[model samples]
Target: MLTNVAVLALDGGHAFELGVFCEIFGMDRSDDGLPPYDFALVSATGTLVSTRHGFRVEATHGLDRLEAADLIGVPASDPDVPQPPQLYEALRAAVARGARVLSICSGAFVLGEAGLLDGRRCTTHWRYAAELARRYPRTRVEPDHLYVDEDPVITGAGTAAGIDTCLHLVRKLQGSAVANDIARRMVTSPHRQGSQTQYVRRPDPGRRSGSLTPVLAWLDAHLHQPLTVDQMSRRAHMSPRTFARRFQQEVGTTPLQWLTGQRILLAQQYLENSEEPVTAIAVRTGFGSAETLRHHFFRRLGTTPHAYRRAFRADPAPPGR
Candidate 1:
């Protein structure tokens, strides 16, 4: 039912967020047995819009194109700048007519201006979460969530999270088959596990050639080894307590937590790009067994390794030399 898609562009937009919408919805994927969306970029202010990075984009369509759209997207824009009256009214009209609306990052602020975020659970980039909450007190802003789907209004957290939000909408409307196909074409994960909390950047640990750099590098190289705090401390020439404290100081997480995250990332690469069995991948990633791998996978990603492979497995490489 979500056939026609339109992205509303305003001045001072983030080009990357706009491109996320364009890449996911603007392409024709019928050759892959996927639905082709009738997509357009409609200028909310005028035909020419200035990007935040000092570039200009000429949107071929105007606000009139929004009337025919079944799903509307608002990419990241200047949150402090007030939205145009006509733009706000147009957004309200679309929602009132039963057309679903989505916002990526700061675009949620636009929805708030349009009065669509009141009493709604939403999210934005973690950096702007405080301002979004302060400006829209009635809205519950879950900063740690990658995306929040409150039915007619969907909000994505940050840049890459916008891709997750768009894929989710596709999965919801069509099915996993279509969404997975599109994700494969885009060369991204079909379904990413975990919240944005894991991605929030921590304060700089100060020293460039810190004491933990070598230890961290070693851990990355030897994820398959049975590593423990005692072993790590021995390598770093520190006591277990000192090593734990140093690890947290430099990495923003404990030794075990950092190792688990690394293993999971490696497992994800294998799931998407290789034909290796789940058990084999488990052993390679230091999970010892498929059961342990599945436990961690479910806890972190909300999906099994096999299911993730099935959804994200890439097309076989062309026969080569």
Candidate 2:
């Protein structure tokens, strides 16, 4: 259903953010058994658009292209520039018809101009977060997140964070396997949790001292086992309370939440790449039973295990086979 994709070309756009959309959605991967999108770059006014880096790119289509787009990407542009009335109306109309729009970095300002960010939770580059909040007072701006997904409108933070936001839409619309395969091709993480904090300047407390890398690696290898905060604390040679505090500090989440996330990720892999039954996958991922797995899967992913497998399973055989 998300096959048609278009990117809006504006003057003084960031080339890297535009390229991120082109790379993720414009590439053809049908030979690799992945779906290829009907992708286009469209200009709101003319064909030749200038970039913030003092370069120019040409768009073959105009605003008419946006009408058919299931997902419209708005790359970073001059936030202070006034958007065309036609472009703003087209964006509102597209969203009105159930089409989704995504913005990268300062592109969130364009969405705000279109009145799409009103009363929605969004984010932009940290440097511009306060301005975005001040301009769109009704919207909740979370500057610390790598991205924010308010369903039909997703906003990414900074430059490279656009990659995370785009991959997340793929995982949401298609499935994890498709998103993961695309990410592997692009040499990036498929699904970085949206709650993960942005990189900030912090003093290093010496290399490899009091690090939790070994513990994390061990947990990765033992995802099939029932992991507990108490057990993990003992393995790390710390009290349970201390371990919980450290996990929140280092991982941005509590130990059990992180472990549940890991198990859910493992279950997603099995559902996509294997023919294992739901019960088998639940047990394999340490969910104890299929019912528990379904509860967590739906709670975390908003889809049941069977439904997710049907959408994402990679089997290539013909239906009758």
Candidate 3:
């Protein structure tokens, strides 16, 4: 029942993904009608930690917590410092004792370092996927997909995918309803991606002083409305032609495609978080119709909203299962 989940935090760990696990399990999700998880942050030292970003975090638990965990989470961390030997031994021992190990972003390196990923399938952030593969030649690393679960050991693709992976685990254990309930409370999606087609239009950003930060923020806030290159151009004070050319060049994606992805992301969030039904989520996310929402959600996430939610909720039986 996921009675205990231990998240390992070390020097230079990214707080956001660490916070992701806390959001899903560490917090009181029961207020949202979800199950409660016993969650704690553990470290090699059982003391306060400083991230690569300069924030300080204290974890009172030590490596002993790994022995009692149903799941062990490894969030993003700096690849510079290697994981301690004792920590690696603790991880190996935990998995040997049947505890599931999860890694987010560059945290894949931690699993690799522990020899847990040898001859197994895994993944990490796209930016460091090549390095992960190069470093762990015995492991097969998938560069796409939001997350890959090798049953006992799972790895998320990047920062946001960490949330998706955590929710996916909840879906696997509790049922779709519970996962959706927690996701809604967190304001995130139940399912984000499938088969890597949605990620095909990945655009590399331009490194000039003119950034798309403002435009991206605007798009995120106004995803419910119809957005065009011309409209976005006007908002950014650039001509339509210039904006289109530069957006494609800088963002490594078309404005339209990015907007569609954002809309899907929003729809996914609503589907997981709210019980208002697919039609309602469609309208709220600007999909216009249930049919449209169905098309995109299935195409992007490889499952329908109903099916996805059902698998992760209180219902133990999946469609085929």
Candidate 4:
């Protein structure tokens, strides 16, 4: 149903993210059985718009493009200077008519200003999540993961994550085979779960110490074994008290949280890529049991492992693929 798409570009446009949208959605992949999107860029005016990095884009269509669109994408831009009232009106009109909307990175600010994010579950770059939450109280802003696709409304983190979000929409509207083919051609991952942590912790003092790297790598390699924070501290040759502070600083999250996230990622891989039973997958992923895996999977992905696999799997990825 969402075969037509309109990408709205404004002043201070993030060219990389905008280009990601075009590359993933605008390119024709008809031979692969993928749905072709009538995708094009629309500006506030049918004129040239300047990007944050000093490049300019010439748009032939204005907000008028939204009229024929079944989906609309808004790429990141500087949030301080907002778009004009007419642009807001046009977006509101499109959503009112049931157009699915998506925002990449700071573009969430524009959607927020337009009131489209009101009472919606959305996410932006982790760096901007706090500010976005401050400005939009009605919206539940999640800072982690790659993206959030809440059916008709979707949002993503900064940079390459936009490509992931767009590919995901392609997957949703089209299907896994089509999405996977497009991704393969583009040299990108077709489906990186939205719940994966943003990245390894940074600026943490504990991990930076020469002693901790090997321990961390070892932990990564042996995740299926019961991992304890105390054991980790000893492995790093540090007192638990010092290790906790260092881990939080270096990773941007607590140790247990990071461990839990890693386990979840492993569990998800088995859920999608293998035919392992839930309990067996849980044990292999170090969650101990299916129930433990389910709790964390739901907390992180907003769905049970079984449900997620069933919805997104191309081949039935239950045990024994």
Candidate 5:
């Protein structure tokens, strides 16, 4: 039922993060048979909000707009700056009334200030994760995720991941068909599970040797085959010990961890787009059995494979144009 949307335009907000909210919720897409949201940009500080990118945006609405919103989007702003007390009060009121609040990147800090993130699991951009955790010790901070949906408060990782976070709320509240159609209009992937890693490792420019790109590309093609660190190490021309170290440094995760994530992603595609039984999909995605698939699905995605399929299976397209 999440039809009404309001985004907070805080002073010094990051332009791209604010744009993510506007792009996902503000546009009129009823022509595509999608539900249109009553959307507005509410200036949390003042009518003229200045972005960190050296531009000012005039928000026609103010904090009063948030009163009627089903979803309130808090885009990234200066985490160090203290938000107005009234802004935080409005947020708590909205959540208390059963509305949802979503934050992109450092916007999670604002939620932390409002006491919304207290005792809740949340995430933010990797670069700011440590600070967020340090600032709000009551909340458990998961640094690696693209987003975390702890019901009333949703937190997204860095810039592009904001799109994933917003679409997820839409999918959860509406349906995957609607989320996917919006994503198609936006020219982006329809669904990236919140459990997916942020992939924050940056390549060391000083060391140009022994990139694992070839092995990773090979692994993608051979996911159906049982894979082992030793086997992959041989393909990368390194010993198991060296390969494992390099993979962790370059990929921000162990090879086995990365492999499991990739397999789960492949299984998700099968469940959504195909009518194959769970056992078949498990084998196809290298989970080997439906039981194993369900275990990983629940652990990583917080749902059973059958439930995921029921929620996300694509709807049949109408015959006539």
Candidate 6:
């Protein structure tokens, strides 16, 4: 039902965020059997909008175009600058009529100014989460989430997470089959749950002497085997306490937390690409038992393994079927 799409082209907006919408919704994918959307770039301030990247875009449509759009995309721009009052009013009207609005990165601030964020949970880039919460006291700001879908107002964190947010909406309205095909065309991950953490820590390359890359590579290869902090610490040539402390500093999360996340990702891949039973996948992914795998799957993904497989597993049917 979400066929019509409109992306706002604000003055000084970030180009990448705007392009995310264009890439996802504007492309003609009907040749591949994917649904095509009626897409347009709408300018709220004027016909010509300058991006923060020193490029200019001409938005042939104006705010009036929003009236026919089923989804409105707001890309990242300066949160401190004020948007036109009419822009805010048009957004409110669009949502009230049952259309959805999504914001990428700092675009959540524009929603806040329009009063759409009040009494709803939302998120933005981690760097702007605190300010979003401070500005809109009524809304709960979750900084760690990749995206928060509070119905008609979804908010994605940072730049790349915008892809996750848009794909999620597509999967929800269309079907996982369509979303998965689109993702394959884009050469990106098919699904990254909204609840997944946005923070992914990597050790600085300059600090090679203390890098945990070797230890992490070992863990990745040995996910099916039992692992303990003591074993990992020995692999890193450090005492257990020292290893834990250093990991927290460089990884932004505990070793066990990171290990669990990796295991879940592996389990997801098996579920999506194979017909393996849950019990088999459990042992293969280091969960030990199907019950244990279900526990973690529900805790982290908010869905059972069976349900996730049903949602994401590729259709056996050929294209155009």
TM-score, each model? 0.66, 0.63, 0.64, 0.65, 0.65, 0.65
Local accuracy of candidate 2 as per-residue lDDT tens digits, 70-101: 99999999889987899999999999998999
lDDT of 2 at 233: 92
Instruction: After the best TM-score superposition of candidate 2, give how far the Cα of residue 65 lies from its true spot, in angstroms.
Output: 1.0
Worst 10 residues of 1 by lDDT: 199-208
Please provide, for model 4 over 1-321, each residue's C-alpha lDDT reduced to its tens digit, 9 standing for 90 to 100.
Answer: 768888987898899888888888788877876767788889985589889898899877878889999988899998898798998898889889999888998999998998988988898987788899999999999787678887677999888788789888878877888778988999977876535342323333344455456666777778899988898888878899888887877767888898888777767666667777898998998888889889888887766888767755557734764
Candidate 4 regions off by >4 Å? 31-33, 194-196, 204-321
What stretches of model 3 exceed 4 Å from their correct place? 195-321
Question: Which number leads on lDDT?
Answer: 6
Ranking by TM-score: 1, 4, 5, 6, 3, 2
Error of 1 at 36 (Å): 0.9
lDDT of 1 by residue, 86-204 (tens): 88898989899899999999999999999999999999999999899999999999997999999899999999999999999999999999999999999998888767754554322
Model 1 stretches astray by more than 4 angstroms: 204-321
lDDT (Cα atoms) of all candidates against the true structure: 0.88, 0.86, 0.82, 0.81, 0.88, 0.89
Instruction: Tell me the lDDT of model 4 at 147.
Output: 88
* Poorest stretch of ten by lDDT in candidate 6: 196-205
Best model number under TM-score: 1
Estimate the lDDT of model 4. 0.81
Error of 5 at 172 (Å): 0.7
